[model samples]
Target: MHEVVAVRATIPGMTTTVDPRTVFETSGADLDAARAVFEQAYEASGFLPERTERVFGYRFRTVGDQTMSFRSTRFDARMVGEVDSGDQVSVSWVTDGGGVLDVGRDELGLSPGRPVVFPTGRPYRFELADVRQSVVQLDRTFLERIAAEAYGTEPGTLVFDHTAAPGVEAVRAWNHQVQEASRIVLGNAPVSVLALADTARRTALALLTTFPHRITARQVPLPTGATGRVRSAVEYMHAAAHTPITTTDVAEHVGLSVRGLQQAFQRQIGVAPNALLRGIRLDRVRDELRAGTPTDTTVASVAVRWGFAHLGRFSAAYARRFLEYPRDTLHG
Candidate 1:
């Protein structure tokens, strides 16, 4: 696949980078048309099925520079192709539908919420139908540096042995992050360079830790605790309530497995970590509503500011926690 070329201006002071962040979409019954679009977006080349193919939809939105970019693609029909064997690593998550990827004698079945990394320099053939996927593409060199520093695995030997999301907990976290990224990249809001960089780092870290890699076996499992780490986990939740986080992150922060953290919370605090986190967020929202006047703060704004995107759930949770509506607190 060819890198996107920048248009040079003859009038001076118009030279720019290759491809700026943009949303590209197209649809029709043309076979080659779809192939070309996907080829430019994903460095994959192959013929589309010549059967009764109806190209219902295909779209991709890209953000960031060549070092890393987050993209989302929607394929409404079957498309079989192979990627260029290059140094670009794609950590992909299938949000909907399913597909089969065959790479170097290994065949993988893709499903919703599961992330798989198509490592650099591997040419893989894919047969995907009606799939909506988000991909984080980064250079292999960047990943190698991260691997060497954090995982103690040298170049070429830091193999991502598995393509699974580890468990249900990891699936939830993965979906949340991928969907969040999709929203940002696809949305109309301007994405600053720093924001895109943060997104790339977070996505890379999640990809590395969620997928089983060669360093996994070398690292010894930290002992689990139910009592000692519960307070620490609670503190972490309270501190990071405004940010996007998961139970797995809390467990990792406290050197415990998710089950271990849950057991500890149950034993010491009489509630699970997630429940306590929700309560803490609810309290923060309530306090904000109480402190601000109705003209200064709206229930919706306050709720969303604290990462409560679903107004229905936020309202329900607020009522359960405070025995009164959030609006009441704002006006009272």
Candidate 2:
């Protein structure tokens, strides 16, 4: 039977804590009961087990919150099943026994020291023969958003296509990174919000980098019309101001460190790059609001499209910048 332990899991990058308690724990020989537990543990819906013959011992345990999960699973049986990853992403390394995951196109052979993302966002099947594995489940939504932000693009572009690492060296590196992140996240000492958030971010970045994926180089916006770094940065801010680009992103685009960019902007433009970016985005928001209608779109929606998430803060900034409120401009 499943033991639902009530333990709080810390929000990544938030002032919270994940109680080190089991989220799911069960061990039984009844195939039907085991199947039910499996489905519940993974939050998986479409689980069609073809055969789980002679289930000698099956144990499952997981910890962590909605952001991520660390799971230990052992099934001593000839288990063959069709399972989906609940539209989430999972990476697992087989410590004992073996399995093959088929995404209805290609197959992934589960081996030791090798972590693989179960071909998700689609139907997949697996056959495990008396296996024990450690699994890390990541919230696809959180991970993808981080990925997109890192690349200065919107989410859902990058896809983890290959299941295996590029080589042996890559495999070892991946294992080390995962283990380190696991230690910080599932460790004894309480972690800082910054530490936890960085851990999660690094893990997500490592996962995407280690596995084979189609990711294009970020077209760091710079203009041929501009000569100096500060000028180029200004041009970039004006051109793609609505993008999810950050000060650091702008700095790198203009070939300067964050501090260097700040210094340059102060020297040349008498203001920080961030200030200029915010002013540009604010102007873009105002322009959009003035052109848009309440029936067509709301002021908050227009503001969010330009990276203004908090309505209260955005309203204050808009008023300070444009001498009027965002809603006033829209209604005008």
Candidate 3:
């Protein structure tokens, strides 16, 4: 059971009066004014949109609270939402122009007039300009129930590959109808709208269970001896992403001399171990920045965590590589 509440009440401890013109405008010099209205509306609804006209998508919103929100121009943009890894998921219909979605690692592409599901706990980035999309989140338990009922038993993992699946059209049509009904429920008795939402949720589960796009299973043949040892070392590095690891440590773990490890990494992974380590460090830094770590987690701390002792040089190198101030990124 879900509760669907009208999103019109003043946010707790915040003022409700805000300008819609600022929140929803075609385009103009009035953008700054619009931005103010947008900010206020976002805060009131608990979903803030940091949008550029060129990229008309909103991001980082919470369910029910509305952490992000947006609307766009006449023409729209098409995008896909995916549930790659998470406990819960929901499908949404509507995509195009200036809409943003968090799709994680699944390379699922959504054309216009398609419905997509975005599962929780996966990292995804989607960008589209000048469009609008209705957002929906699915209940994980509900989906699993449908999956068991439809497909004998649900696997530990399931893939919805749109290209391979034949039932995408049906799911799309069903999503459109659900979205329409949602609008009506939202406008009418908003308090009891949960009944309609629950129906949509159940329908979505049934549709997804039959969704076309089952990913083809591929076999990864394992290598023998030296090659396998080298592969294990590389895998270890990736798995220990947050730790400050060293090449000597890696070589010892893989039962190889330091020089041998260096040779193997260069020959196979095409990069030196230290260079690969730096790449991983840089990736970790980006991830930390995106996840909204504490402001006190400064650039210096980031560098030190990655094994860079010199603050000045580390900042310079980071700027040259990422094209932005390290401090700005850390704080932002």
RMSD to the true structure for each prediction, in A, is: 21.5, 16.0, 18.5
TM accuracy, model 2? 0.56
lDDT of 2 by residue, 52-97 (tens): 4544767887766566778888887766656545436788888988
Q: By TM-score, highest first, what's the ranking?
A: 2, 1, 3
Q: Against the true structure, what is each candidate's TM-score? A: 0.51, 0.56, 0.37
Q: What is the lDDT of residue 304 in candidate 1?
A: 89
lDDT leader: 2
> Candidate 3 on 83-170: residue-level lDDT in tens?
1223334454455543445434444554566666543332345544445555454444455455655567643223444334336656
Pairs that collide, model 1: 226-264
lDDT of the candidates, in the order given: 0.66, 0.71, 0.49
Q: Write the per-residue lDDT of candidate 1 for residues 1-332, one digit (tens) a residue.
A: 12243321121243442223544445554556667878876644554753324446566556556657677777677878766425466777787877887644577888886777764333457778888887777765576567776765554324565444476776677667766766655445555556666676666676666676663222111124322355456656766878878898888776568997888788875788888777878888888988999777899998988889999988988888888989988988
C-alpha root-mean-square deviation, candidate 1:
21.5
Better of 2 and 3 by lDDT: 2
